[model samples]
Target chain A: MAKEKTSALHENKGVSQPKDTNTRAIKNIRTKRNTKLNTKALVASILKSDTVALSRAITLIESNHPSHIKQANAIIKACLPYANQSIRIGVTGVPGVGKSTFIEAFGKYLTSKGKRVAVLAIDPSSSLSKGSILGDKTRMEALVKDEHAFIRPSSSGDSLGGVARKTRESIILCEAAGFDVIIIETVGVGQSETTVHSMVDFFLLLKLAGAGDELQGIKRGIMEMADAVVINKADGDTLKHAQLAKVEFNKALQLYPIKASRWKPKVMLCSALQNEGIDSVWKLISDYIAITSKNHYFEKKRQEQNKFWLIQTIETQLKSHFFNRPDIKKELEQQLELIKANETTPFAAADYLLNL
Target chain B: MAKEKTSALHENKGVSQPKDTNTRAIKNIRTKRNTKLNTKALVASILKSDTVALSRAITLIESNHPSHIKQANAIIKACLPYANQSIRIGVTGVPGVGKSTFIEAFGKYLTSKGKRVAVLAIDPSSSLSKGSILGDKTRMEALVKDEHAFIRPSSSGDSLGGVARKTRESIILCEAAGFDVIIIETVGVGQSETTVHSMVDFFLLLKLAGAGDELQGIKRGIMEMADAVVINKADGDTLKHAQLAKVEFNKALQLYPIKASRWKPKVMLCSALQNEGIDSVWKLISDYIAITSKNHYFEKKRQEQNKFWLIQTIETQLKSHFFNRPDIKKELEQQLELIKANETTPFAAADYLLNL
Candidate 1:
């Protein structure tokens, strides 16, 4: 078995380490001088565009060890001043929607345009799915070999917040390492897409033309969040259906109010298998960047995202602290039962439990 | 102005009291036994179908007074056994889509069917506006007079969670008072609709026939949250447009994935002013209840809502505690500045502020 097999389900995988490591990670890092020195070396290496050092820093960020996480925060802080120079795009789709192939083609096209691209994944399912992103990295065989493109597999975790936080910090490391474009790929499971959407400048949804696509495409308001929807596999017999989907999505997109960015979302066709329409996807994103930059929405959104993550971080930690307690676990079940029996209100139950 | 003016923003009408009353309300309620006697009396009156008692109980729940909140929790606990007997329906739309009239007609219609109804509002805007729900009660004058109907204006609070918690607790008091149906009305603002949606069984979106309604109706993913969309003002000049809108909405609703309840959302046309198609709206809800109940989704959803509220209460309180700290408020500003200047990551800033 491959070394990545550890993150997979031994029985079924997703039970990765950490009954209570999220806040523990933050707590262990409290203004340690030793952490800053090691972080300095990591930061120096990353600023020199050494992907090896970037990967190592991210490993520290993903580690369950308290000391590693301590150094990780320091590394992130040191990398911060050299970051924020890349365009972060989030790509998402349901399984079998060809997300990996689509990104591989898109990343290759950007690299051809002299842009150094870094691809990262935020798949919460990967923990249970036998190193899914590592598998994807190998699938992007051609792009992986390109010096201008770097692909890192997602960190395995059961917590979407923990996974997302790791990926978010990784973007900084990638940026400081001179990656001009960062593509954050996530599978269409749970709230992963929304998590990615919040962390990215552009959110692109890849869709197959048919095969119950219309039924699931609009689930959870994913359609509303799309800055652009690219109908992938728009080659051969599927080409006609893909065009129809574009028209349908175009009409559907107009029903939404103008986004705060005041930039209209567009739909395009692609065939990553045929490597067709990849450049148009890049063109669409470039146009989005141009318009949003001109309107100042780009910078404003990034600032708001910063504030969102700050609060988000604290909230996630708060929940972890409250929930990871052994006492609260038993008390919560009792409260839930009291709720089901209508013997206690959820508010009242929560008050009791929180106080307890 | 009415007595409700006290809740209105003196500056413009929506800034009701509570510099810090949410968690404070809960903290003051801990393990107090003296509260039970007053609550026992209140619960007795409510079970006897006394609207005045029900209103008073809700007032206690809405009060920022520590003793009032303690007594309120007892009242809710006493009322719990009699609650869960009502079908909660959330009605929402942008202002001027005739929600007040629609609910008035709908409430009156249900009363005519020999169903006791309680109408409650959850307008977070009431804190800024001059007694909006109080004004709405007047618009619902006929229903207000119906012995079979009870109306309580929304509690005033800028915190949607606080206002929502008050309304949720009020539902128990209403149910204990023998109301068979509860209508939760909210104005489209911020996340009020979504807040209302989380607490209801049937989420209805009211839409005007035309006038840029399509653009704003779907804003913030509200359309996806609806279990049904009713086209209002379908009488006289607007009737044709309303019919057209019904068709369009029907098409749009079909595009969404089937709800977890496995129920397909319906679109209907209504003219509350003319009382046209009011019975059909009831029929639609009846059909929904029959199907969801048969599938066990109705009870399952209610149970899930119980758990959701339990967690929501804790999460809201957690955020309130963190953000309300004077130190956190100042520190957060500095941290955000650090983030914008790229001197630190949001996660790093969050850790620092949380520690401080």
Candidate 2:
């Protein structure tokens, strides 16, 4: 399978056929080194909140080599006892919303208060660009320099489902590493926000004050999932607009149905640049945790999210396995075209492909 | 599978064991007879607007008999040439919103205009009740008695996913049967409305004049999917409230981003009992069709729907097949317990089960 991917890579560079020499050699070295890592030692180090071991363990989870499966499973199982001790927060906003700056401010405040924070991103689109918002050191310099904060960009070169699975597993490792707070960052452009929302304890959506695209962000289906909506860059000239935006958002949210959690989603104003109102944001999260925990919704939500990811992971794997079949791939395009042309019904097409 | 389901049904009576006698006898006769149904004749009759043949064909699509697969595929293939000729509309509302009355009035109006209209419901909850809104003669008396209209309740004994597939296939059959307008009805609760929206060209949401559950409908993710919102029961004392609702909904919709079709969703007041504003509703549909068809959105939407259903059906089947395994089922409960106890991560548990 690795060789096939390698060949496909070469073909994309105008090579009609793959020369498996260099790719095979590099892949063999990586596989050997990955398999040689001691799982017990890694788990022990991770339990001590060792960042190096945590990175290695996450690498094992992201590895596609067949040999890494048992090792990855062993490490995760060993770390499972220490997991789920942290709050998982999902933060998202569109580009130009100062998401990285807000995250940096948020992380700095948590670390200053003697908290360990781990930040992970789930950006499937990063595979194409080789660049990520959190990956940029200049953007989150304060968090990057903070000893108690660990910021990891998205794992590139994988489908969103694959990245989601890896990120979810990484959360377990982060929790086991004694990180009291875990923030999952996502670009609020597409379906990734929903995926992140399902895996987190609280979902926060960032919006720009006085932006015309406020409704556009809501149209993407992120607003309803939000636990809080923060209007960023609320310093200096944007202060008035930010306050008005907060009021407008508060009114807009009332039009939505009451959430099952029975917790009212708050709209807040924040300026990451000035580091203003960051404490209020933290207070909101703390209040939510206190109230929901008292009502038993906090624990209930975690269990539900666990079950959701379990089913979601299995379904994603099943689909990929089916579509990866050589015969099915050979026939899929033709069947899709037939369906588009209305020459065959989608059911008939699916039946044909399944039977094939 | 049919035999298994039948035996399970009998076992539910506390018989403790299955006697294959009556179940097998009934199943064998039905399977053999259904397998022998002439596909060409069925298509010929359906193309000539025979509701009886259309109902029989829908039964084929809904059947669990293994022998019916090829016959069902043949019928759908034969009918494909005549499908996609009708305008598909999805209508939904919460219970007690007078959905059936509105649909009945809407269907009657279309049929009275010399158009053949087909009404199908996609209510999975109706399976347990053995009665459906569309099945009520008193509610839809006019449409039930109209010669130009064909009304069918939902197929029973299936999950929502299964029911959706059947409903989608039924739409094709109805379109092929010379129905100029096809209305797919769904309860305005849960995920069924999303399913209906994906398969239809236009989505209509029905709301009552003074219901406090207006936001409740939006919370279910139905409001955003609506191409039009109809404030039903706009007569007498409710007229003012209905007009107010129309204005409110129109304002609410303006906060949403422009739809991909670029067609602005409209809000209108109607009295199904008084049979007023029905023509205006029809005019809206006609105008929408004319504009979207001119811009080629109608064709583009159908093709996208075909592709969506194909992928959706395949994914649902894959999940069911995997979870249906007895061993997987047994392990699933244990794993879920472990997950709830925080003894295992969802990804790790999924890996363990998938490897099993």
Candidate 3:
């Protein structure tokens, strides 16, 4: 039995030799061919507004894939002219402000008006889990079924600001796909909200009817940037509270110097769940665009937003490069330990690390 | 007289004699020697804990004179070992939160305990006017009379953060001069508060009673970093409101994850005008330090702060360098104009500038 098994093993080894070599060649060929094909298809499909293909293109951009970046840039350049044609609106509020419901209701209204609306929810939660809920579509069942309405949740796995960048780029793709309005929905109010605000043409801040304490927690600088403040969940028991909040917000807005747009930021009440006051919010936004565009403030604002993104992008990249250097990293750790031991000052440590 | 002056001018020009050159050279040498002696004496006096000398040292640091920086660095190094010994406390609140009054009361309390205290006030408004009020000492009449107390105002010019860096470095000098506690007072809540907080061992956020809106405007992240939250003016009609604020803050703090120190943040009510609750605030800070130090969290926090500073410094310098570049500046202006004209997108414009 041993002799027979040995003969069989030897025979198998001899037979596998040529087959292994042939298989290895075929596998390499297949991989190379698949990569090339994927790239071509991604570019073409993204141009055609295929959601899956656009997602893949964004993934390529986010992953720092060298080839993907080159192709992404090419696709962007091709789609650039079609971009910046849509009105980009940024929506943000604290957690539990019914952001998803509002977007769903608002998107439905726009689609009903025969306008294509694209809802791009920039999820800060995406950074922790490489998966985004992309639940806006599921929640906005009415809007999801509309052929003219598109819903894309944030692609997870990046900084909040980085996610905003991808979403901003995706906005361009959406615009090229012929969407008339692009709404960027952020998960919560904070730095991410500011980031989204910096990217969009119109910023809408959603708030709940609460005692003025919540208002105090909102950064005045952010409030100053809002084009409109909507008190959401203004229905039933919340109606009186919402009205009070609207009045309080109006007073707070007055403290801020008038914006360059010459439009007093309007405070309005809305109920996303009941689908009440959605049309009024849209009308107010339309009026804002008309007034500001007529005064040329709209164009000026777009230009400012562009300049901000430009500087922000460069600064982010420069910071990443500085932090990524191996020697700098080691020296930084050592210096930090020294600082921890109180052996050296933070200023001196900074100087040493920077010089290093 | 004109003829005499003309004759002297002619004589000086015509004289190629060594005597004339020697006299001129002697004058130049005299002035240089005088300058050197003055600077050395100034630095020596500053090291001796003389307020006038300290003022001179700060001036030298702020000046553009090439030798001034070297002299300043030498003095700072001499003072370094004595630094980080003091419990550096940073106090910040909105304007009219009685920041000065609170510091005055707090400074007196520390002095009463036989502790030497130094107050450094960072006034962001001073940057534009090139003058700082430096009113902490004046406000704390009792503390000012105490030989163990010192007060220094922020220097004008540069960003608030830059002023903070200088003030932080100055604290070392003050501590070296034997101050046991250093209080950095900031007007209004802003990035300036964050800057001061980073340098200090304890951060005290001052809030007014019934300032719910103001409280809400304060970002949770910043609030999470505080060692203690003090509701100031907790006297008369404001007393109840202050107590209520304390409860609200305690609730708000629970939302944040456990801080690095593992010390539960304390919220206290204080009437700075009455000098009531000042000692409690100080006690809370001391308790925080003691507990955190025993657990070795104090050292860990300082290390994290140092790391943050290093990255911040590099970012600042890089930003300055990028903006200061002649070519980049030119391109930025051109791009701004193009963006204004809607001829290019901001992201593309940035990419172009960065590549250039």
* Top TM-score hit: 2
Please give the TM-score that candidate 1 achieves against the real structure. Answer: 0.77
For residues A183-205, could you state the per-residue lDDT of candidate 3 as single tens digits?
98875644777788878888999
lDDT of 3: 0.78
- Over A59-160, each residue of candidate 2 has an lDDT whose tens digit, in order, gives 888999866767887888888888889999999988888988899999999999999999999996788885776667677887888889888888898888
- Note the DockQ of each predicted structure: 0.55, 0.54, 0.39
| B1-356: candidate 1 lDDT, tens digit per residue | 56654654555547678766577666556434446656777789999998888888888999999989878887888888989989999999888899989998999999999999998988877788656655543588898889999988887855788888898999988988899999999888888988899899999999898843464436657878998899899999988888888877887787667789998888899999999989999999999999999999999999888899899898888778889999999999999998999998888888898789
Q: How would you encode candidate 3's per-residue C-alpha lDDT over B1-356 as one tens digit per residue? A: 45554543364446555656578889878877876677667656755767767767777666656666666766676566666677888888877788878888888888889998888888887777734657433666776677778877777777776786788778877777777898988765457777887888888889887746446667545787788889999999889888888888898888777877788888999999998999999889889889989998877776666677767777888788888999999989998787665556666677788788
Q: Which candidate wins on lDDT?
A: 1
> For every candidate, what is the interface RMSD in angstroms?
1.6, 1.9, 2.4
The window of 10 residues in a row where model 2 chain A has the poorest summed lDDT is A4-13
Off by over 4 Å in 1: A1-47, A93-115, A134-138, A205-298, B1-44, B92-114, B134-138, B188-190, B201-296
* Model 2, span B296-315: residue lDDT tens: 99999988888888888888
True contacts kept of each: 0.95, 0.97, 0.65
Show pairs that collide, candidate 2: none
When 1 and 2 are scored with DockQ, the better candidate is 1
Candidate 1, residues A224-258, lDDT tens digits: the string is 89999999999999899988888888888997778
